[model samples]
Target: MTYDILIIGGGINGCAIAREASLLGLKVMLVERDDLAGHTSSASTKLIHGGLRYLEYYDFKLVAEALRERERLVKAAPHIIRPMQFVLPHENAVRPWWMVRIGLYLYDFLGGKMSLPRSRGLRKSDTLYAAPLKHGGSGFVYSDAFVDDSRLTVLNAIDAADNGADVAVGVAVESARREGGIWRATLSDWRTVEARAIVNAAGPWVHQMLGSLGVNASSNVRLVKGSHIVVPKLFEGSHSYILQQPDRRIVFAIPYQGDFTEIGTTDVPVDAPEDARIDDDEIAYLCEAVNRHFTTQITTADVTSTWSGVRPLYDDGASEAKAVTRDYVLELDANGPALLSIFGGKITTARHLAEEAMEKLAPSMGFRAHPVSRARVFPGGAIADFDTFHAQVVATWPFLGEARSLRMAHAYGQMLAEMLGGITDEAALGPNLGGGVTEVEARWLHDREWARTADDVLKRRSKVGLHLSAAETAAFEARWNAMFPREPSYA
Candidate 1:
């Protein structure tokens, strides 16, 4: 069947666009070469906030759009997106006090009718927050939301599938050409599929995908690598810290997996998207950034895990990688079969970007202009209050422990009932693959969430890998391969 839209790349933008198009009564198909969000989408800072730093570049429009989306996502997916406070320590050596105060005021004003508390100034004597800081200076506390990034992408794909879109994972679009006013795409496995229009939402590989289709476009994407390191918990609070460096860049130290601290993000330039591995210099750099603000000092040895992702920013001739704009640009070529290529979008604004994409391509695909509500809840994301819903889950499942109950509530949300399958005991959960990886949960992700390998289940669908031992992780891989022998392997 010729789908009305064939979306390439199963990252957040592609999945979101697929969901929007499918809901508008268009037959859609989304094909991903690897696991959904196996790249850039999953390796994010995991914050749904207006990029406060972007204000320095006079990017008020981008910040406002992101803030609005942030409010929408927090309400639509309360379980996955939760409000968190960020403590921005004042450094006399970096940004001036007046400048920082003005920026905070603008941030609060732009984020109108926020569900979270407004930004406030904290004195140095506020022991609760200041005790952890090495520098004895006042700071500003602002509100933002955190998200389960990979799961958000998967949920979008799931919603699109539920709306009659065919979701294909581990499928690569090797070549495509305009044939008889249709996109005839040849897959890596040598299968051919036709679609009326093609949406290239391939993150970090947008330029390469267009090259493969023989469409010569002038705009090039600047590949910027952002790396993060997970270390032992540094502070004693649920709130995160945004530390400013003497070099004018900021690093965030957030609470991760309940026990570890997540510190991140160095802006380094790279030649290719595949070269997204963190180096020794980046580790030392992040450690130094944390040491500047926090009382505790860390080195490379304290690093537990590290990850890196390449951002495909639209090349606007910015000298520094950090200065590149985060705003997305949509290029629609209506010369033959419609091809819409997206570049430089963040997780917070993906839904809005998807909505605009459909608006541009609707006429070419022969669909009337149909608008979707930003408040539309994703699959398993219907709970109004997370704490209340989690309490209800614990009440229903008396055998579930506190940690397990909260994990289920956050990961599965309303779908926890179906995942539980009326089972009532830990033994019935079937083989705790160390951490929270039970046979039942593993099978649920494999069959329902398109998780092919142990990594997909342990790392992406659920962060159970952080809790699992090395031996247990290896054992889970062996079991998964032995049971699901028919599917392709994933990294």
Candidate 2:
């Protein structure tokens, strides 16, 4: 098969790039070695926010651009992304109150015309903001957004497919060579395809792909491991806490999945990205940060789950790991057919990164890309108001139950109608798999979202694994294995 552009990787950046390229009228094909978001993309703090700490690095452009993108994403995908309030306590705060205020003022200004509430100072006696704090001191509250990170990536992939881009998950580009003014690539399935340009958005593995692309580049990728630990519910409020550590790093304790609090992330440098795991020191640091900020303390034993994502940051030769830039670097080698490599991007700016990537490669690929002032919503994100839409979902599909309907509304948005439109009975939704997931939903995930494995369905496609018991999960896994066995041994 011949295509205008071949994108390698199925993470957020790759999916976003495919959507942008396809929307710009390119016949695009995106290939991933594993399931979509099977790596760094899924293991995030699950936030869509401007890097508040990045302001100290004087990365004003990155912060402002991220804040703007955060706003746009919240508006575009209100179901999966919503405005969240963050409280930074005053006592034992790393930075002075004046500095934080100034920073927040700049943050609000950088966002230009804003839809969310502005930042403000809160009194310590104001128990609503102070109830969960360890100290009876004042704090600063600012607005950011929370996201279903994996779902966002999947929606972008789905939109790319809907826009005529072929999203090939569980497939890898075995080899590629530039010839006859086009790039011929061999896939793991032994299919040879030709494309005018290639985008290497392989997340942590981006640098390793460079040599094969025949682009001897000088840029370095400093792998930074950021880990998060999930523990039982810490605080009462819906608002998240931004706890500043004594070492000048900040950790967040955010409400997650209704029954637990998720806290993260230490910038521990690593040599490799594969199989990243948190060490005792990192866990201690996170626990201590939470202990110092909140009245409810936690130990390592309290950690219900943990995830570590390796950030493949563009090396800037910083002395400290925490000082590394969160901004991405895009290198295009148009020596022959175009080859673009992306490094070090925050989830908040994936769309913008994709746009810039397409803009950079459009000329070489023989396409005039259309630039957008603000990005369009994903396939299922067209909602005027999220709460009202949720209410409509609950009213329309009363059989799904309010709790299930609410979760579905957030995850699928307007797509819920398409999934559950004609089904009047709950049983028609399919047999219960566990954690509110059904056979029908699993089938939909497989057919539409390219969910091939149990992990792809429960872990990435949905966080149902977090809520299931060991036996329940095993049963579901067994059933899923039966449905889509990896290798059909004998057919």
Candidate 3:
């Protein structure tokens, strides 16, 4: 069966587009070469906020749009997206306090409605007590939101499936061609399938997708590699720190996973987008950035885990990779049949990006642009109040204490009820998979949520891999294989 829309890439952007299109009554099919959110989407800084640094680049429009989306997402998925405070320390060596204060005021006003707290100034004596900076500088606190980026992608895919879209993981688009005024695309999985309109939302490979379609267009993506390191918690509070580097770029040291501190993101140009990896120089750069501001010095030895992703930045002739625009650009070739290629988008703006993409494709899809906002609750985001929802889950599953119940609720949302179907006692939740993760969640992910491999369950669907041992991973892999054999790999 040919689909009205065939989306390539199961990253956040692709999945979000698939969800929106499917909800609009389009027959949609989503294909991903690897695990969903396995690349850039999962490797993000994990903040859903306006890019404050982008303001310096004079990207006020991008920042303003992202701020609106940030508010929408916070309300749409309160369980997963929670408000976070950021402390931007002002050193006399760097910029003045007045400039920083003005920026903060503009940031708060630019976003429109003020669901989050306004920015506030902090005295050096009092602020240093909380942040404990090595430089003992004054600072300002502003609001942003934290997200489980991987889960956000998964939830989008799940919502798309619920809206009657065929969401396929572990599937690759081998080739795409325009034939008979329609896209003739061949997808290879355990088998091959075909489709009509193809969307090239393949993040880093957006250029490659265009090439595969035999379209000659100027290369638009400038691949910039960003890396992150996880360490033990640095400060005592929930507030994160945005430290200014000597080069004028910023680094984030945010609270992660209840017990760890996540710091990162160095912008470096890459010769090969597909070959993006973290090297010693990038790691040293991140460590130096952290050590420069914090009281506790951190080296490579303090890093528990490190990850790298290639940002699909739009080429704008910037001398530095950090200066490249984060705004997405949609390329549509009217001369060729209907092919849409997306470039340079962030997690915070994905929903708005989808809306814009749909607007671009509406004419070709034989439909007019419709106003469909993602401001409403997504699949598991039915609960209006997160605290009340948690109470309900705890009351129902008394065996699962507050902490565990809250974890599952946030991870699964309203789908937590369906995941908990026909299970009451701890034993019914399935075998201890090691870490706090259970077999029930793993099975639900496999059977219902399109999770196919051990990594999909451990690394992407749930972050249990961060806490599990090497031996435990091996054991879980064995069990996963016994239950579901790896299909022939694609792409």
Task: Give candidates' CA RMSD values in order.
Answer: 1.5, 1.8, 1.8
lDDT by residue for model 1 (147-238), tens = 99999999998899888999888888988999988989888766788999999989899988999998876677899999999999998878
lDDT top scorer: 1
User: Which digits, one per residue and each the tens of the lDDT, describe model 2 over residues 1-491?
Assistant: 99989999999999999888888878999999888988999989999988888989999999899988988898799888889999988878778889999999988888888888899998646687788787765878899999999999999899889989998877888889999789999988778999998899988888788876667877788899999999999878788988888889989889998899999988998988784898888898899888887788889999988889998898988889999999999998889888889988988999999889988987876677667526698878999998899889878878888878888888888888777768888889888878888877888888899998888988888887888889999998888877777842210
In model 2, where do residues sit more than 4 Å from their true spots? 487-491
Clashing pairs in 1: none
Query: Comparing 2 and 3 by lDDT, which wins?
Result: 2
Candidate 3 residue-wise lDDT at 154: 84
Q: In model 3, which runs have C-alpha deviations exceeding 4 angstroms? A: 123-129, 190-194
lDDT of 1: 0.88
Superposed Cα deviation of residue 49, candidate 1 (Å): 1.0
> Using Cα atoms with residue i matched to residue i, what is each candidate's TM-score against the true structure?
0.97, 0.97, 0.96
Q: Over the stretch 1-491, how does candidate 3's per-residue lDDT look in tens digits?
A: 67888899999999999988887888999999888898999899999999998888889999999999988899888888889988887752366677778888889889898699988887545653345687675677889999999989988888889889998887888877777767777777545445557788999988887888798656588999999988888887788989888888899999887788999898989866676688898888889988888889988898888889999999988889999999989887766467788888999988888888889988876877575755668768877888899989998888877667878888887888888887889988877665666778877888877888888877777777777779998998888887778776766
